[model samples]
Target: MSRKLLNISIPVISVLLGLLAGAVIMLVSGYDPIQGYSAMLSGIFGDEYYLGETVRQITPYILAGLAVAFAFRTGLFNIGVEGQLIVGWIAAVWVGTEFDFPKVIHLPLAVLAGAAAGAFWAFIPGLLKAKYRVHEVIVTIMLNYTALHVTNYLIVNVLSDKQDKTENIAETASLRSVLFENLTDLSRMHWGIIIALICAIFMWFILEKTTTGFELKAVGFNQHASEYAGMSVKRNIILSMVISGAFAGLAGAMEGLGTFGYAAIKGGFTGVGFDGIAVALLGGNAAIGVVLAAALFGGLKNGALNMPLEAGVPNEIVDIVIALIIFFVASSYFIRWIISRLSKKGAK
Candidate 1:
């Protein structure tokens, strides 16, 4: 098969295999796999409310996947999306609640604040990686812990005046749509999905259609050669991380301004940032692919809630299925070999 067809087929096959494996697991665990999957599908698409909720979940997944995919394109491993998103959540809420600007200015400014905060957080690791040869993964991993505590402290000590959450953002900064809510039977869907789609397009344009993109890809392919060709490898590394973090921050903004309309202290990691790694891997790190992967993830996540209710199966099985899918995607090399062997046998 052509590389393009192979790229598409791998993910599709992985997803199918994952579902099959999940069914096997369900059978072993004494649950009706068919009923479980049927309920899952029903929860995701059988009702307008669930469909809207799935789209709402998808919005942030798209941005998070874009963040990881963008970094991968430039040969960067940004493990700090969680931290970047944490700071962005607070930063956006701060601007949203503190400002009295008009809707047009307030909403845009709040969103920009989130993007800027994430960029700044990501910049630290980028700068260190470029100048000191420090590994970004280590630095970003450490920063996630720091961000969690700091944001929690800020929430209790500053933003919320000893509360665990901040106040609701101003009406001007809210991304809520009453019309959409009514249409979906009060689901949390918002226009953030539009923003996520736009950002996906932006990533594609920058990486595939721009001079900067060429330089970034060149650096990713070979930094030493890129530098010899006069492309500043250091600059591209920093730029890539910054852009990736901006997308991550926008993911936080979707939650803060769209779904929750506020920021809250968390007892643990949000998981969305980490899940982005899987989405990017499963999507082959391409913009369109990422969007599709995000939708699948969203559907599974939203639909998982119904598994126990209708099929007497634990919802955690969905997570297992997702993990299986990601595992298969990551093992694409082995799968390719298997396919190649099968094809040769068929030809013989």
Candidate 2:
């Protein structure tokens, strides 16, 4: 098989293997895998409301996946996506609650606030990495804790000062849609999905169609070579992180403006950023791939809620399947070896 096909087959085979393994586990545990998965599929698509909820869940996931993928493509880990997203969420909420303007100006402005916060958060580590040769991972990991506690403190002291959540955003600033509500039986689906798709297009255009993108990729592959070619490595590194942080921040906006309509005190990580790592890996760090992977994850997560009602099974089974998918993706070499052996045996 061609190299590209081999690469593509790895994820596909991994997903299949994950499901198969789930089935084996289900049988051992005296549960029916077929019924469980059937219930999941039904939950995801059985009603218009469920379908809409599935899409809503997917919106932020696409952005989160893209954020991680963008940094990865530029040779950065961006472990601080969680923290950056949190700050962005609050920033957007602040704009939404504090401002009074036309929808045209207010909504976009709130969104921009989120992107800016995320970019600034990620920028710190990028600057450190480029200027001092400090590791991005270390700084980002610390920032995650700082973001959680700081945002909690901010919610309690700066914004609300009286409650765990901020005031509701004005209608002009809200992504919530009466039309979508009417269509989906009051599901929380919003226009955030549209924004996410646009961001994906933006990433694709930048990475594939511009000189700046070429420079970024060059720096990612080999900073020394990029510098030798007269490109400023530090600038590109910082720019990459800035762009990736913007995407992460946009993911937060989806929650603040679209999903929840307000910023609440978060006691812990949202898991969205961490899940993005798996999505990016599964998608191969490509825009279209991220969308597809996000859809799979979104469907699984949304549908898992119905397991108890429909299949008499725990929703955690889906979690196990997702974990297994990531495990297989991480163990790509072993999977490739198995595929190679199978291909050779078939050839004979």
Candidate 3:
């Protein structure tokens, strides 16, 4: 009972500390923290449109968070989710634009293309790690740049129009839903949120109810022990990366098929992958936790835009708060210590 309570209390305390620290910063800067917070809440929940937009924004974050969390649970660091997402986006766009098929066939094919492209891109690093003992972090980081340039080259030389963006995907290949639009008061929210939720459930099931999951987690906990126990650590590593990249790729599909119906040439990283790390960490790398954490992040990001307009606070202050939250989350040892001390005092 105490363990479960501690698990819950630690994150809650960390969040409160982060918010308190942010309030202090705002006070020091001569801004009203209460007003800023009130505006932020209102912006997030003011109407159906804002709520829908927040959900839409969180759709990708949830998938990306799951990707990172899945890898983390398997004792791997997948920093290349951004690269996988890029390649997946291009692949989805390519399929959506080039294919002529029925809505059912085309949409699924485009989504699959995105997932396969992401898996393939991640496979390279996984293979290198398995065969040559290469560090996945270094390989994935470098691959991010490689994926960016390669996707850009393909867009410029092969897939793009005069405007440096891919042609709009066919409507039949889109995941947008008029019904959802009407329900959300004309926000960009789409059927992709359904897919994201399904993926979260799928991730939870895979991790909690499967023999393969047990082996993967065993390998993660102790590779040597897992190997001695007849588990294949190398195989698990490669498989973990592949699955992680697939989730990230699905996130890319949400952008291509739902948000934009086209792929734009990017100047740099999308930052979604980087944000996934924070999401995974704050969520304790658990599947359900990732969903909740992603929603919070999505709300913050959606609400930040209104801070300056409605509350006379700089939007960048939200970024500072987010950074501080990450800091507090990373310093979880301190929070745990405090909790332990409190528990001991109560027992005494």
Candidate 4:
């Protein structure tokens, strides 16, 4: 019981500490923390439109978080989720624009194309790591720049129509749902949220209820020991990266088919993939945890605009709060020590 409570309490306490630190900063900056927080909360839940926008934002965060979490669980650090996401976005938009199929076929096909593209992109790093002992961190990081340039070039040369953005995807390939729009006061929310939820469930099942999961986890725990135990570390590493990239790709698909319905040439990284690392850490790399963490992050991001407008606080303050939260989460050992001391005092 204590162990279970500890597991839950650590993150909650870390969040509280982060907020407290942010409050201090706000005080020093001559901003009203209470007003800022209140406005932020109201912004997130003020209307159906705001709520729907938060959910829309959460959709991709969930998938991206899952991507990082999955790789972490498999003993791989997949920093290239950003690159994978970009390629996936490009692939989905390409499929959506180039093809004209029935809605039933086109939407799924485009989404799948995104996932396949991400998987293929990750496969290169995976293969290199497996065959040559190359470090995945460096390889994936470099690939992020590669993905950005390659996608930008393709958009300019092949996909775009004399603009920086690709043409709107075919309606048949879109993930937007009129039903959700009606319910949410015409917000950009779409059926992609349903897909995100389903993928979360799928990840949970795959990680917790299967023999393959066990093998993958074993490889993560100790590659040499797993090899001695007859598990193929190389195969698991490749498989883990492919699966991780697929999740990130789905995140990109949510943007391409559901949110934007097109691809835009990016001058820089989308930052979603980088944020995934924080989400996975805060979530403890668990599927359900990732979902909740993503929602929190989504709420913060969605509500940031209102903080400036309603409370006269700079929206960048929210970024500071987020960074503090990550810092606290990273230094969770201090929190654990505090909990242990309090527990001993209570027992005494």
Which regions of candidate 3 fall more than 4 Å away from where they truly are? none
List candidate 1 segments past 4 Å from native. none
Off by over 4 Å in 2: none
lDDT of 1 at 317: 99
N/CA/C clash count, model 4: 0
Give each model's whole-structure lDDT: 0.93, 0.93, 0.89, 0.92
TM-score, candidate 4, is 0.98
CA lDDT, candidate 3, residue 279: 88
User: What does candidate 3 score in Cα RMSD to the true structure?
Assistant: 1.1
- Candidate 4: tens digits of C-alpha lDDT, residues 76-104: 99999999999999999999999999999
lDDT of 4: 0.92
lDDT of 1 by residue, 1-348 (tens): 667777798999999999999999999999999999999999999888999999999998999999999999899999888888888888999999999999999999999999998899999999999999999999999998998999999989988878889999999999989989999999999999999999999999999999999999899899999999999989999999899999999998888999999989899999988988888998899999999999999999999999999999999999999999999998999888888787789889
Residue-by-residue lDDT tens digits, candidate 2, 12-36: 9889888899888888989898898
TM-score of each: 0.98, 0.98, 0.98, 0.98
Residue 148 local lDDT, model 3: 93
Best of the two (2, 3) by lDDT: 2
Backbone Cα, N, C clashes tallied per candidate: 0, 0, 0, 0
